[model samples]
Target: MESTTWEESVTDSINTIYLLFSAYLVFVMQLGFAMLCAGSVRAKNAMNIMLSNVVDAVVGSISYYLFGFAFAFGVGDNSNPFIGSRFFALADVPNSTYDYTFFLYQWAFAIAVAGITSGSIAERTQFSAYLIFSFFLTGFVYPVVAHWVWSSAGWLSPSSSDLLFGSGAIDFAGSGVVHLVGGIAGLWGSLIEGPRVGRFDAFGKPVPMRGHNATLVVLGTFLLWFGWFGFNPGSFDKILVSYPDAADQGNWTGVGRTAVTTTLAGSAAGIVTLFGRRLLVGHWDALDVCNGVLGGFVAITSGCSVVEPWAAIVCGFVAAWVLIGLNILALKLNFDDPLEATQLHGGCGAWGLIFTGLFAKEEFVIQAYDSGETGVTRPYGLFMGGGWGLVGAQVTEVLVIVGWVSVTMGPLFYALHKLGILRIPVEDEIAGLDVSSHGGYAYVAHRDEGHPRYYADYMRLQDQS
Candidate 1:
């Protein structure tokens, strides 16, 4: 009896430790995001970029907690195929220790994925509009898609999914759900907001907006890389080595394997991003080096669990190439995705999802190791001879999300433009968001000798609205 009790205690402790670590890593990714977006924008906009990240992180968290928690996870009567109808306002959640623990852990994920879109809209969006968008996404869109995969009754769930792909859509780690949703939204958002003023001339010759500080960008990139281990691997329930044969898990193998694949692919992305940048540009750029590491991790997320470590390397390398290309194309298209969210998360994420269909190993599938599947339904990837059906499913999902967000968001933003609520007034845009929106300055204005400063601060401000 004592031995059994001790084992149970060990399992409980392990669960807590894993959950805590994962939560920490995910939470810190926000800082990486802040720094990344900040660096992408001009120095004049740095404070505004950081402030938006901070606000959305806070706002997204509260909204997800208050209503999203239950709607995404609360069980239904046999589980609904579309929306999670049970936990409407987090009312059904109990006060048990597990309930609170589950809430906190899941909350971190909601925050990370929801905030991913902010990078795309960093400089130009209205602060008020962004706050509203974050709440709606966390409370409704992000959660609903999350349920479609993670919830027992969600339509994407293998047990109940009736899609043409018998095993359901194959976004093993939210490539289709989280990254794509944010990417599509970011694309539409950038389009509606339009290219930043002075970003292009009448001929559309691309102009470069050099980032404020490369040092901050590098540090932020490191933080994101550190956090992803927890983000991908921690999606699994915590496993206890002492209770290797416990009902929850047969071993710690899944988590360990996931970490290996995640890091390996990230490494591949780093090298490929390095080479791609060197070959494509005059030299390997620091910004590419920083984001290339991230590009790898994002590319590997979908297949991290199923692919071999070396396959991860290959996937990451390919994804790095994709990311760099997308960034270049984005400039040509006049899409001002300042932080490259559309590339790093959306482009690489899509690549990762498709790769999962190609490289997943057979034994890995049969091991009942996919924490995403909740066991029961085992689907094969291309390497395992599953063929093109799963790939079709993944494509369908990407279209569904992109098409849905575009249709809904495009018009909404256009209407806001008409109403004059989308972008701030021209004067405010010239003044910078820190002073106009956040009511503060991000940096000490340095003196420029012999440079006459515009004395607009003393002039009465006029509201465009």
Candidate 2:
């Protein structure tokens, strides 16, 4: 009995280690997000991009660790309507539940969403205002939604199904909660913040603002794609709740379905975007192509575990279409999306969830209900006449989410605007964040001849207005 008990203890320890490692993979995506922002910003503001990414993750995670975790998972049982309330500062997590593992994983997600907002408002928004938003948004709004979807007791829990309520939304990862919410919030920020000083011409037409480094964009995009493998499939609450007698399948293939669809969609989006940009712009844009891959990944995230192999390819193509259109609209509207957050994460994430409604086989829905089954039968797509019922559910859900985020965020931003604290002083904006906040220059792009002097002249014209 003694020997057997010792072996069992050793095995349990290993299981805990594996779960933690997988969660670590998910955490590293924040670095990927940071790089993506770096790739997207203008050369002059590269430090700004890097700083926002770094600080948002640090501040957002700490804020979440402090209180956000409890708000999302504090409920005592599977049947609670509200988020867990007892875990403020994470005080009550049972030791048996791998306590900090859940905290660690969910915190990564919160950081990612907060990081999404960073890019949208990067160039001109004040770091002080950003710090404020990160505190409230991550610690409150985001956790409340996570509680709704991922928390068992929340109203949208799988066991709490209602067509109108969109319970068990099959988000797989976080199309609605993370990406979509970020995107809508970003849209609001961009709208109320308005374009950067000269992002638009006097005629209100768009002006081109190029990212500093195509190579950085490509590398950052690749990093995000790689990390997504851990993200979508890691949605399995099963990882944390291990069965004592269950068979071990290393890195489960049901999770592979999520990986497969995600990769396929990203690839399809990349190809389509490259060709589309070439056909339209007369030159293929590496940055646009990067966005395409990201767009596809976001598009497939919701439906990844719910769709068939072929459906993934189709989904990717469709998501690319949405991405291209939204990006074009942003430029035309003079929204200076420093990192294209709205089109890539917001637009694609919303579509991905709707795609789940269209492509998810009824059988898969049943499987997701039961917990370990892959629900291969449930992956039937609209091509097979899955019909408008699922489609309608998706449409309604997307509209509600978009409406919920936009309506609330828009007003919040407008109020922030009235207060005049939304942006940094003009001198700070010109100096870049490294010099302004960190007391050092991050990248030497400022070393290029005439950059500061260049911006200085431009600032005078704007201030004259």
User: Please, what is the whole-model Cα lDDT of each candidate in the order they appear?
Assistant: 0.73, 0.73
Pairs of residues at least 3 apart in sequence or in different chains that clash in candidate 2 = 74-84, 75-84, 361-378, 364-378
Deviation in Å, model 1, residue 382 alpha carbon: 1.0
RMSD of 1: 5.1
Off by over 4 Å in 2: 1-15, 77-89, 161-167, 239-251, 372-393, 426-440, 445-465
Which stretch of 10 consecutive residues in model 1 shows the poorest summed lDDT? 446-455
Candidate 2 per-residue lDDT over residues 24-103, each given as its tens digit: 77777887888788877755577767877788888897789778887887755432455557446557444674566667
RMSD of each: 5.1, 4.4
Candidate 2 local lDDT, residue 238: 49
- Name the best candidate (by TM-score): 1
lDDT of 1: 0.73
